[model samples]
Target: MTALHWKLVIDAADPHAQADFWARALGYTVEDNGAFIERLLAAGHAPAELTVEAHGRRAWRDLAAVRHPDDPYEEATGIGHGRRLLFQRVPEAKTAKNRLHIDVHAGPARDRAAEVARLESLGASVLRDVDEPGGRWTVMADPEGNEFCVQ
Candidate 1:
């Protein structure tokens, strides 16, 4: 079987906070894997150095995730089976433009201008607005500076 299971992994300085922002922006839910964490702690299988207290709860300080609202998820561990974004802490800041970026498909019913307006209200900023003979799209950045597009 193929080994792929995750949709996307985001690098962040503060993973838990980033996960929270993204969850609200996308109308998604943050995964609550505290049960699994607690179990590991209780069984003495988890290293004490790997856990942290976040938002008055036990959490992994290095990584956190959020999932699409309609996706199927495991109730026990709170991991989703559909589109999800995982954020992991990293020391280095983003130093260059993203070689790989996401395209927001708001559908044909909504054009780029309207989408841009909506996204801007949701904490996205327009990096550039490009119009070419082939098509048009707005280059935008998420709240944390990750770039994406509205097409």
Candidate 2:
């Protein structure tokens, strides 16, 4: 079969921290590729400089990922099959607003007001609230300033 997968790769100053924050915020599980790392190290395929001790375990410092809680994951590697967000280390800060953004659909049952309140409690700040003829939504920024919408 042809390869087909969807993942969002985010550039972060601290990939592990980002992964941790996202894992908590989205109720996701952080991927633990420690087994693969150990295998590479044992085989001399991974350079010492590429590894670091994080959370008392060997991890790749440059990249980490978090996946949705209900998604199917590989137990050995802790990689998931669906709705994954990969965070990769970068040296620079986010200089501008995102050209693309994520929207969290809390559903009409929750109502926008309650959802916004809940998100605020989870460390999100309201950026703006829009009311249009078709519909309305509230824009919010995550702890690291990534923008998302609640509708």
Candidate 3:
């Protein structure tokens, strides 16, 4: 048996914006993909309409991604080989709660409240605070209303 490689793909109205937000929030790196895009364009395989300038480089207009900084990636294409999140543009709006969510753990050395405040500063809104015998966590929504937790 072999393990498969995969990335978490999110639907968003603005994939580039989502990538930027997640990259900063998670201390990750935005995948460049500029060189690959350029090659595709030069080879007449991709149209210019499908690309946009991001971070001063070419990127897929409807797709963007962020990856853990320490993870392995393909240098030529700037595609992450591990721990990646891909955001793709979608026409429809999010109308329901997410079935799955991310939980950000504030390690014992870090202050949870401060972390929550920092996330709020980055366009996240606090939904509510949970204090239970199991543990305490703060539910929050991102700029696009995706719910996640800060523990």
Candidate 4:
């Protein structure tokens, strides 16, 4: 058997903004590496030029992450050690459709329409509504235009 630890990586123009949107969408929490960054700077092990102010706090200029709300994390760095998605800044914009995407299951007990509406309020736009022989779902795009489905 093999052991593996993984997190999805997404490229974005603004990693912090992407992290914020995904955190709200998935009910996740954004990782706060401020303390660890400060420690690194204080010890002269890191460059201050690699840091930025985000969400009114210090954060890595090019990277941010969001993790499942129930997952465990490091206290000092606030970096999630469990299920998470990491966003990194890139020079190029998303120029095409996403080859990989997320499917959000609001479930039968949950109001999918209301959920969609809520997501819309959180900077997601509806791409399309689907009602097919297989099942019904809505295709939506995040603030940065990454496509995801709500089912």
Best by lDDT: 3
Model 1 ranges off by over 4 Å: 1-4, 47-49, 53-56, 108-111
TM-score for each of the candidates: 0.82, 0.85, 0.98, 0.94
Q: Candidate 3, which ten residues in sequence have the lowest lDDT sum?
A: 17-26
Q: Which one is best on TM-score? A: 3
* lDDT score at residue 48, model 2, on the 0-100 scale: 73
Q: Report the error of model 2 at residue 63, Å.
A: 1.0
Clashing pairs in 2: none
lDDT of each: 0.84, 0.85, 0.94, 0.93
**lDDT score, candidate 1:** 0.84
Q: Candidate 3 lDDT, tens digit per residue, 14-108?
A: 99988998888899999999999999999999999999999999999999999999999999999999999999999999999999888998889
Candidate 1 vs candidate 4: which has greater TM-score?
4
lDDT of 4 at 57: 81
Better of 3 and 4 by lDDT: 3
Pairs of colliding residues, candidate 1? none
On a 0 to 100 scale, what is the lDDT of residue 125 in model 3? 96
Q: Rank the candidates by TM-score, best first.
A: 3, 4, 2, 1
Candidate 4 collision pairs: none
Model 2 scores a TM of: 0.85
Q: lDDT tens digits, residues 1-151, model 1? A: 8777677998988898788877765678888888888888899998868988776677887999999989999987778889999999999998888888878876879776887898788778999988999888889988778998888
Candidate 2 residue spans exceeding 4 A from truth: 1-3
Q: Which digits, one per residue and each the tens of the lDDT, describe model 2 over residues 22-106?
A: 7876778888888889988999998979877777788998998999988898887777889999989888888899988878887
lDDT of 4 by residue, 7-94 (tens): 9999999999999999999899999899999999999999999999987788999999999989889898888878999999999989
Q: Which ten residues in a row have the lowest lDDT in candidate 1?
A: 18-27
TM-score of 1: 0.82
